[model samples]
Target chain A: MRLELKEVASGYGHRTLIRRISLVVTDGEVLCLLGPNGSGKTTLFKTILGLIRLQGGQILLDGEDISRWPRARLARVMGYIPQAHNPPFPYRVLDVVLMGRTAHLGPTAAPGREDMAVARRAINTLNISHLEDRIYTEISGGERQLVLIARALAQEPRLLIMDEATSALDFGNQLLVLSHIKRLAQMGLAIIMASHFPDHALLYASKVMLLKKGQVYSLGRPEEMVTEENLKSLYGVDVKIIRAELPGCNETRVCVPVCR
Target chain B: MAVARKQGSLTNSLATAEGNYRWREIALTALPLLVFLFSFPLGRYPISPGQLLTILAAKVFPIAPTWPATLETVVFQVRLPRMLAAMLVGAALATAGAAYQGMFKNPLVSPDILGASAGAGFGAALAIYFSLGVVGIQVSSFLFGLLAVGLTWALSSRIRHDPVLILVLAGILMGTLFSSGTSLIKYVADPYDKLPAITFWLMGSLAAIAPRDVWTALVPILVGTLPLYLLRWRLNVLSLGEEEARSLGLDTGRLRLIVILCSTLITAASVAISGMIGWVGLIIPHLARMLVGPNYRELLPAAILIGSAYLLLVDDLARVLTSVEIPLGILTSIIGAPFFLYLLLNARRGWV
Candidate 1:
């Protein structure tokens, strides 16, 4: 699957917060969107997911304009994983994942044996099948994030859109989740994730797009796009980009904030 | 492979839990029937369990009438309609409550949160003030209940920010407005006749429920409950909040409309028949949640059964506890309030 945004403009209710944005994400690719607070990253994602009306331009799914498509149809092609938050009720983990089949089932249908099997497969793929019967509200924050990702996967979509999915996790859990995301991309799922960490983009993102003031500041290969200069301008902060070589691993870039 | 093995072990435990839940569901399904049968022998009329059974069985079989003809009148004409009304109203209010709580994503929400009861109360008060008959009172009450919720929905839609919060706020505003309307009508009504009638009606009871009233409420309650039962699975998705549900391919607007329409229908029908019965809708869903987890598939049915049994038991108490029957609305509040407090203090898990 391929997603193309052509000069897309979007915002809440008549005011365009993000405009003139164009990008392409294809299968087996991880496109990381990095921006500071209020850089219109969330709004842009909402537009792509068709949560809000497209203020201008077109979004094409495999070269087909999908601005007018129904939400159920859009969901069949794309899955959205929002940041992990506790819902009011204590739904079991398996029940949460099975909810992904809503698009696949009839309006009044409950999850059947086939749907449950698909949900279990998604949970197994994330290695969280043991958490299937646990209460979603009782799980750890990082585990909850994985459960949500598994839920998105259960939708059986070609593309996954994640919004700061790992922002709430600890360092180890962050890497654990990012590795799973990278693995998913490698297995031929197109993924677009919004992140606050430039280092994450360097580690897992195939392509990086730096958004500043509702427009793309720079878009290119992560190695070229996640430079110290772009990072400084994007967040209005100075940072040192350090190259490190770990034993039995390729060289990697890490961003360290320069405190005054 | 280790993870798979761990999952296999957990599956066994989960299977046990599922078995337990199945037993609980069976118990819940049988509760209302058991309550209904037991309640038959408890009224002021001295009918023993054996006699009650024989009287009930006599309807299907040709048996010699071993008891007085008045026993059959009390059983069929009086007790039967009242018990059925109690169960029907209980189920309707509780199901509507469960649906509203899920739709609003709040544990504290009740069926009358959208002012259905308050509007119904006002309508009944106005009908009594104008000397309308019982049927007129019920019809007007049902219509006004729908009107109140419709106004809330319309008012909330005009505001674009924080849809759920706006909706709740609009509902509260409408509730207060209609409640004051009821109070105002009560003040001006004839103190000797209409005032007492309005007051008793608002207090809520099934003492006057007839065979016709039961049939009247039954149609709308069943009509309203069918959609909710069919859409029970979607209610879980809806409880995740509007944005998340919509992203998962649910048309949140349409689902919200359906839930509101159905919940309002049931709540209005209940209030129209039983007057302003409070706390049953507010508390019964919570009790059901304690028995079954919040998955609506189980929660809804659990709520319906528990609610039906609960009201029937309460009505039996009202009948036998004293010569003068206590109003059901008052009794539910008397029971529901302190139980709600206990749930608040003892709820270890979040919003069961």
Candidate 2:
């Protein structure tokens, strides 16, 4: 399915934070939304997920207007991986993932064998089978992120939206997750992710949209849109872009800050 | 998935394999049935277990009834209904308590968190002061209990920020309001006839429960309970906080409405029948949680059985341990407060 946003505007309670933004993401494309803090990135993501009311304009999924779709019907077609949260109760990992199938099960129905099979398949696909019975609270942050991804995968959605999914992870875990996210897009899932790092977009994103001061700065292929001047203008920081080549890894550009 | 679930160290002592609590559940179920059977014969009427069995059998199967007419009346008309009322009250309070704890996402919550007990108390006091009969008192209590919660919900829904926090605050306000109203009634009542009756009603008992009161309360209690039972599994998701639940496609507002309605119905029904039986609602669900983990699918049913068994046992002790009847509320508080402290001190054992 293709998600097309036309002149969408959104914010909290009469105050329009983001306005007049248009974008289209199709299957097998990774749309990386790059913005500084308070630049309407989170607000836009919430609007797409229907967590907040839309201020104006229209959102269409596969040529159908989805501006006011029921949350359950919307959930069946779209999956979301929010930032990791500490649950007050310690649910089993498998049970947490099985919640992704809520749209498929009856309101009162327990997870049947078929639903369990689907959950098991998701756990296997995410390589989290070993963590299935473990208490979710006792797991490490990296493991929790993987489990959440497995939960979204269990939903079997065509469109995947993530909000700052890697902002809390360490370097090694961040690379581990970013590569996995790239692979998911390669497997024909349409993905929109907000990230603070432009180098990640340069390395992994098919398209990048830079948001600044509640408006879109630029939108295009990462190679064409991302530049040294734009990075400085977006973040108010001076930086140098260098090509880094390492053994047994692909050559890539890295962003390094320059002190005055 | 590949089944390589080695039981971890943290869960080694308290947790069994998932789905392997079947034996413990069976034991819990058996304890309740034993308590129910034994409770029937332990009342003030001089009847042995064998004699009780004979009376029951003679009734079910038409043999020559060889019991005294007075014994039969005491057994069937008085003791039997009281026993059933005790069981029903206990089960309703405990299950409602469990649902409220999960609904509010706080283990400290009780069935009366929404001013139910206080409202019922005020209503009963008002009824007694005006010389309302038994049914009048019950209906008034039920209606006021609902009114208290309805006021709380209405007040909280107006504010959009931090809805749960506002709801808890509203409940506290309503609780204080109704409790003060009850106190006001007590202060001016004629210290002879109406005051003692109001005091007794507030202390709570199953002494006045007849087959009719049981039938009256039973319908609402069962009507309230069916929704909770059918929707038990969903409670786990609902307890995961509203934003997360909505992300998982749960209609959280609707689910909360249903849960609040059911819990209020059961709580109001029980409090109307027996005055303000305390501790059972707060303590029994915790015991259930300690035995089974926090999965609502298991926890809710476990709570119902344990609550039924516990109140039955407590009622027996209330009658047999004293000459004149001891109030149910006092006994429960005397027992429930210490257990609550213990649970708080050792919260690692599944209170979370």
Winning model by lDDT? 1
DockQ of 1: 0.82
Off by over 4 Å in 1: B1-15
Query: Against the true chain A, what TM-score does chain A of candidate 1 give?
Result: 0.98
Q: Model 2 fnat?
A: 0.44
Check candidate 2 and list the clashing pairs. Answer: none
The TM-score each candidate achieves on chain A is 0.98, 0.96
* lDDT digits (tens) for residues A1-260 of candidate 1: 88999999999987999999999999999999999999999999899988999989999998999988887898888899999999998888999999999888888899999999999999999999779889999999999999999999989999999999999999999999999999999999999999999999999999999999999999999989998899988888899889999998888889999989
- Which residues of candidate 2, in runs, are more than 4 Å off? A247-250, B1-19
Q: For model 1, how does the per-residue alpha-carbon lDDT over B103-210 read when each residue is reduced to its tens digit?
A: 999988989998888898999999999988999999999999999999999999999987888989999999999999999999999999999999999999999998
**TM-score of each candidate?**
0.97, 0.94
- Candidate 2 C-alpha lDDT tens digits along B271-300: 999999999988888888777867788889
Top candidate on TM-score is 1
Clashing pairs in 1: none
